[model samples]
Target: MDSLEQTMADAQARLEAAVADRHAAMHSPVVGTPDGDMRVMVLRAVGQGLAGLRFHTDARSPKVATVALHGRASVLAYDPVARVQLRLSGPARIERDGPVADAAWDAAAPFSRRCYLAEHGPGAPLPAPGSALPADLLARRPSLAETEAGRAAFAVLLVEPETLDWLRLDAQGGQRARFVRLGDVWSGGWVAP
Candidate 1:
């Protein structure tokens, strides 16, 4: 709040906290693609100094293809209680097979992994509106072996932020700062709210 350095630090701190705590308001942030589509996605991981962010997705999903073509994205997270809004924009990539994707898939719970096992990718049409998961899987978690089929559809969306805008609102007024990343270094300054 006192300086741009502190503002940057606070933004990173909030993002890190969101990764560790699912209950955090920013845990599920809005991700926007070049196609003007946006969806709320879980915050899977965050790298040191806010270098990168990780999110899980279905490889067959439309967003994956959109991101692959555009190679860019925007993420927005707002915590009503804290009255903070964080907006991030940067280059993005999708990985279906990699150390990061493998580790994220492995770390997922059976129930969570079961999501990738859906009979069809997201937004698939059905004879009748219903869950995409198989009827049998609806009752219980799939075995580890069963989840293997989903690995092909599982993917990790990595966003390396090139810019970050942080805003804090209060009764008095508001504080705002903008940061731009060049290589491993960040330069930023306070801006009008």
Candidate 2:
């Protein structure tokens, strides 16, 4: 492969490492709130392929509202141990109560599904701390079919990245590059680190 392709592949590998890092977060850098503030979200790597990365969130959450208002956003994945960081910019599409969301919800972990089972919406004012799920449901893992009840509150944010930029800082030196999508083409080049 050419140098540019190799750089992009290396970047993707670093991003995958970050995503697979259980100790640290698989995070997105910013989501523009309607008021134009930035929100950082620790997202689960629900899916990553030709469709780009997908993250699951609550339909009533602020992030969903934010994405609805401003589809443009960026995701930053960093692996401290690997000394690699990847920044991806894209347009986010939020899907709820649809086929896309259905599949995502169904694929979610049982404990994760419990988040949607809360009686109140996310960030709701609770009389006390915690998600405030029913006492019974809290003790056990809900079945996949049981999770269906929470489907209405589940949402999937699919981000189609137009640009994927990366930086690798090491003891020896630092390397930076970016792959930008212009129309139907995807071209990449190095940058000063």
Candidate 3:
């Protein structure tokens, strides 16, 4: 709050906290692809200096293909109680097989992994509204071995932020800052809210 550096640090802290704290307001941020599609995704991980953000997804999801083709993404998160918002965009990629994806999949709970066990990808049409999970899985969580079938459909979406717009609202007015990354370094300054 006293300096630009502090503001940037606050952004980093909020992002990192969002990943670890499920109840955090920013825990589920809106992820957008170049195809103009957006959805709320759980925040899985945040890298140092806001370098890379990790999210889990189903490889068969439409966003996976869009991200693979465009190699770009945007994420927006807001904390109503804190009156802060973070808008970030940059290069991104979907990895179905890699250390990152593997680790993410391994870290997921059985219930979480059950999502990828669906016979079809997200948004699949059905006769009636349903989760698309196997009939048995609908009633109970899958065991570790049962989740193996979902591994092939699991993926990690990694977003390396190149720009971050951080804003905070207050009674006095508001404060805003924009940061751009160049290689490993980041340069930023205050901006009008």
Candidate 4:
């Protein structure tokens, strides 16, 4: 292959490796939660672009309304292998019952849709134990028609990352880097560890 092709392949590999490393780090047990707890599933990354890290929640969820009102949120992703942690801050917006919501709904499995159909709201009270599904719904699992009713309840949270602080720990020394977006441009630089 040509030199340019080799260089492009290497760059693509590096970008994929970075994303995979970040994803693995986020699944680590030592990750921190917004409530100051250490939890593995603290954050859910959603959305569709490099600038977007999306999360899905019920429209009635407090966090849903919070981000809707505030338009900002944060996420922490840690990589155990590289001993790196990424702290991301961004502006958030809610997309409900639109193309984005429809797309997200279509991507969900029927079982997940059933949960939404069963719940009234994000933190609504649950049915008594042993409660049974309606006979018709029981004879057959929830169909696409049954799940459609819950589509309005789902909300897509779009977060446009504004800044990312990458911190790494190493034996010789530590490393820190910060990336900030300004208009259409993204600029980054190393900082003191």
Error of 4 at 193 (Å): 2.3
Candidate RMSDs in Å, in order, are 0.8, 3.1, 0.8, 6.5
Taking the tens digit of each residue's C-alpha lDDT, what string does model 2 give over 37-141? 666665545333323566777788877887888886677766667677777777888888677777777677888889888888877799878756878898899
Q: Which ten residues in a row have the lowest lDDT in candidate 2?
A: 42-51
| Candidate 1 steric clashes | 0
Off by over 4 Å in 2: 16-50
Model 1 — TM-score against the truth? Answer: 0.98
TM agreement with the true structure for every prediction: 0.98, 0.82, 0.98, 0.69
Error of 4 at 78 (Å): 1.4
User: Per-residue lDDT tens digits of candidate 4, residues 106-144?
Assistant: 887786666566445645566565323344554456887
lDDT tens digits by residue: candidate 3, 63-105: 9999999999999999999999999999999999978888888
Ranking by TM-score: 3, 1, 2, 4
- Clash statistics: count for each candidate: 0, 0, 0, 3
Scored against the true structure, residue 71 in model 3 reaches a CA lDDT of 99
